[model samples]
Target: MYIVILNLTDKKADAPAHMADHNAWIAQGFEDGVFLVVGSLKPQGGGAILAVAEDITDLEARVAADPFVSKGIATPHIQQIAPARTDARLSFLKDVA
Candidate 1:
């Protein structure tokens, strides 16, 4: 599992220009079953993505392809997590450990 943070950068104002493409990229992530969750970061800090992938390279490549990254509208920081345990509803996350 990974937590991908799209932290806003100096070019944040350019976001609206790339939003449609960014949204398309997000949709592709979901359609591909890589992104488990995605949403805003409070107070206009950009966004975050919860993703799971078998290969870190694949995940890095995916993040690299986000419009926000390509356009320099945000910077990405990927944090890997090995799920040791989870609540009953989220037990599936443990498989990625």
Candidate 2:
């Protein structure tokens, strides 16, 4: 599993120009089953994504492909997680870790 943090950059205001394409990228993540959850970072600073994937390298490439990251609207920091334990509802993630 991975946690992708998209922290807003000084160019945040330029985000509107690429909003549609960014949204399309997000939709593709869901469509491909990589994104488990996608939501804002609160106070509208930026966003975050919870992704289930086999490789951190692959996830890095996917994040790079995001319009927000590609266009400098946001900077991405990806955290690779190895789940040693989880609540029963999230047991599936343990196997992946």
Candidate 3:
């Protein structure tokens, strides 16, 4: 799984131009089953996206095509994680072994 963190460098005023396209990309990502979860950081400074894919190449390609990236509204810092353990508080991991 690849964890992509998108830091919004631009101001909120510039969000509108990229919001629509960003939402569309997210919607498509859901349909394609590559997106795990996406949400904004506290105080709306930026946002983070979690994705699980076959490889970094695929993840990179998809993120590179995002509207925010294309418009320079955001930049992504991607990381590869190995899930060591999880608590039951997370519903999604309740049944995961």
Candidate 4:
């Protein structure tokens, strides 16, 4: 599993230029089953993405594909994790470890 943090770098006024493409990129991630969760960061810092992939390179490629990254709207930091524990309902996450 991985936690992808996107820290906003571009001005808020620049959002309109990239939001549509960014939203589409996010939607595709979910549709592809790579992104497990995604949401805004507190105080509008940026956003966070929970994702899983067989290889970190694949995850990196996906993150690179995000419009936010391509447009220089935000910087993404990917933290890879090996889940050693999880609730019974989410035990499946262990497989990604």
Q: Give the C-alpha miss distance for residue 44 in model 4, angstroms.
A: 4.0
Score candidate 2 by lDDT: 0.92
The C-alpha TM-scores of every prediction are: 0.94, 0.91, 0.84, 0.89
Tens-digit per-residue lDDT, 1-97, candidate 4: 9999999884655767889999999999999899998999999779999898889999899899888887788889999988898999989888863
- Which candidate gets the maximum TM-score versus the true structure? 1
- Expressed as tens digits, the lDDT of each residue in 3-87 for candidate 2 is 9999999999999999999999999999999998999998878999999887888899999999999999999999988889789
Per-residue lDDT tens digits for candidate 3, residues 1-97, read: 6678888874555888779889999999889988878888888677788777878888899999998887778888999766656675655633322
Alpha-carbon local distance difference test for all models? 0.93, 0.92, 0.80, 0.88
Sort by TM-score, top down from the best: 1, 2, 4, 3
Estimate the Cα RMSD of every predicted model relative to the unseen true structure.
Answer: 1.2, 1.4, 2.8, 1.5
Rate residue 71 of model 1 by lDDT: 85
What shift in Å separates residue 72 of candidate 2 from its native position after superposition?
0.2
| Candidate 2 lowest-lDDT run of ten | 88-97
| Model 2, C-alpha of 46: deviation from truth (Å) | 0.9
Which 10 successive residues of model 3 have the least lDDT summed?
88-97
Residues forming the 10-long window of minimal summed lDDT in candidate 1: 88-97
